[model samples]
Target: MFERYLAALEYPSQGGINIDDPKEFRNIVLWLEDQKIRHYTIEDRANLRKTGSATDWDPAYAKYKIDLGFPANLKSKTEELTWLFLYAIKLEYSDNADRYRSITAAQKIEQEKKSSAAPEIKSTNPFDKLDFTSPDFEEGSRKLAEKLGIAYHPDHLVSLRAASYVISTALNKEVLKEPIITGKPFPIDEGIGMGFENHQDLEKAARILRLLQIQNLRKLQTAINETIVAVQNITADPRTDTSLGKVGMK
Candidate 1:
């Protein structure tokens, strides 16, 4: 029934339809709300070994809230509907539905779980080996010296290297703290201390990295969408391909 509604919305196409039309969007939202309420009521009653009825399901409705552990109860039908609507919109707007779905689903689950995990911090000594010629090595040393208002030395350089490693590790750990679809940490390469030859080169590198990251995210979304489609037995229509191209889905 959910998939049928999604199909009615003509999802899986680029910019498939404008949900900005308040009346129509609201109608769709209401329909989704009804569906969710009915589904939840049925599931809850079955779990409790009770004869499920509208009145009997009232107690099952609860506000969604994040706790230290366990998924939150669904707060309201509106929230569930909103999520479904946004998901469909995202899928239609972005070519990479799979990645979006995976990330979104993981986030939703994490929100419910109220994850208490903290990032792991790693520290290292930088001065054991010296490679001052490399921009990354030199820049790290220079930044540390400037920040500390101290003269540069081999020992200082080593300390700076260690600091850089620590900072990079902390950042990566934070990213990993987020729940992932695979329930495994993402593989991050060794931290490269920032040391570009010039500002232009730095800007270019940043831009390239951003683009690559976006593409990677898109790929992930696409994979997730494919998985969902397969599980739901949704087949890709040839018309969807043409429609996607028309809306610049690439």
Candidate 2:
């Protein structure tokens, strides 16, 4: 189902496409229109029109998510399938999906085996080596921070300092907006709190924000999966087998 779209994406005539390029963007738009005629059945003119205020890819997706319990009709099943194909193709062609496919099945199995046999490795934080706590580094940091125009409070966390440097670099490259940092004397989190602010180039800021959001979402999903397994293990009896086949020691 995703083959056609994925093929076009992975093997464009240019070998790759710059979406920012006008020719490339127009080519993709034409390809999608052509695909509709050749492969799928998106006959609805309203669906094809992007000028509308109400409906588009994101809106339709949100609608489908909320109306999940609604039964599909025999007549519109074809249309639904076409939409599904489009959604699946887009998802499968994304960076997230590419990352998911990075490891082969054999590599995964080998990794699992190694993980089971090897000693547990403590996760290392990248900020650990960025020791901004030292007094000697403070003066140099101040001078650099002043040059860059990014907010750099001496009391800020090392993690935050590193982030500031990254933002500063982005600001220097883009030269679009100043990086702003808002801090408060919170009761927790080392008594200083920080968060994302709308204080940089919109596109770049959105990209980084989305990346962080995706990371948090992945962590939340992992926590939920682990919690489910832990609950089942604790509650399930080893001697019995249910429709699920087995649980706990069983």
Candidate 3:
């Protein structure tokens, strides 16, 4: 996928730049490519050619390319290449989804059983407290719905699902111990088969992150309470600490 993205950018396959190196840089590649595809449309092809957002595209790609001794020129082919990249990404996602679905029902059941035996630390999603009606969230939800080709009525369940995807992805990146963004993109088709795999993976990650956070807090609170109780008991003791005094005096 990274190589395909590089090819779309007209980057050389043989060069000093290792396209698969230094995990952080690889993550940036994934994030950029995902953002581009999520925003792609048939209507924007003309606009892309006529006027492009170099401000949007240049700095990140150029930084990596320069080190590899490639020219930083990406403006002219931006539209053509973007379309190709989106096509490739969507195709690969479909292939992966098909492969994933081929697993037997028994295997899935066993896997679920194993997962269920694990301890669960339940917590309310921080997103539950958020004001979804805020302008920033509303605008984000709209863009997300448009990206996923979901109908965008504010009151609709589909819109809420889209909002959850956006929120979960953000939380998984920012809050999780192993951030999901540094990992792979969602694994299924975004539009037609969204809820089956792609959206499910993201939501599961988000739930794990929220639970981990709540569990950690509970542990910390327990430790603190224990420490306070110990201190109070020591303070209330009528006897002086003979062992400590003996050691200090000696």
Candidate 4:
């Protein structure tokens, strides 16, 4: 998908994509996402340019002589391309939902099994105390999320929120196992248990981070639910009545 985006830029449209109109030049090729998230079909995704984003970009796509399924009602190249972007992300969200469901279901099972044991009071989400009253946090978080291309519209916040918590909680689990020393210690079985420093600061840090993690994890679940609902609200296929791009780009 991104290769097509780069290819679109190669043809010079919309002043070409404004990478610096945003931030950091990270390679968008992310095969490193969670193993559960994957291509929805066997289709060559890089060649997934189903519609042109600009009349100029049409030539670039035409140079390759590829054809895309014209989106429903969008006639302009830009509109079709924009719709394509939404569709692509929708596909991504769909895949992520699957992964999220599986992970959560497994977690639920684990929790059920553990429920028979003594109850463990878990940390509250630190994110709950965030200063949402001030516009700074929401504004900054939204912009940063957009810059990082995580959550763009409010609808996408669900997946973004969930993913963030999953990361924090997973990290906190490791941090809670503290007395962490950089260097390898002698085997405990050999009576050489030494050099592990238990800092009060780490204990506090772990608590804060854990709280934040738990908070976000629940938010993430909410986000996922909202996203599923949002998807349900799309009643029309935008490309349904659309015509294809006009052939001449001169």
Report the number of the highest-lDDT candidate.
Answer: 3
Q: How does model 2 score by TM-score? A: 0.22
Query: What TM-score does each of the candidates earn?
Result: 0.16, 0.22, 0.19, 0.19
In terms of TM-score, which candidate is strongest?
A: 2
State the lDDT of candidate 4 residue by residue for 158-206, as single tens digits. Answer: 6457557655754477866876567875332343223333675665556
Over 4 Å off, model 3? 1-198, 242-250
Cα lDDT, all candidates: 0.51, 0.53, 0.55, 0.48
lDDT of 4: 0.48
User: What lDDT does candidate 2 reach at residue 130?
Assistant: 65
Residues 1-250 of candidate 1 have per-residue lDDT tens digits of: 3444465445343433345453444445334334432333544334223223334332332221111121355465445454665554544546555645566657856864675566666657664465767878677777876765555556656767666665675447786797755665533322443455367567556656866797899999999999998845533444444533442246
Q: For every model in order, what is the number of clashing pairs?
A: 12, 0, 0, 10
Give RMSD (Å) of candidate 3 vs. truth: 28.3
Q: Which run of 10 residues does model 1 get worst, by summed lDDT?
A: 61-70
lDDT by residue (1-250, candidate 2, tens digit) is 4344445344345354444554444344435444432232355433333423334633543444344323354244334434544654554546366676677889977976886796766769875666676766676677666676656775545535765767775656565565665687432323222343344355455655666897899999999999999877766756554576655452
Rank ordering of all candidates by lDDT, starting from the highest: 3, 2, 1, 4
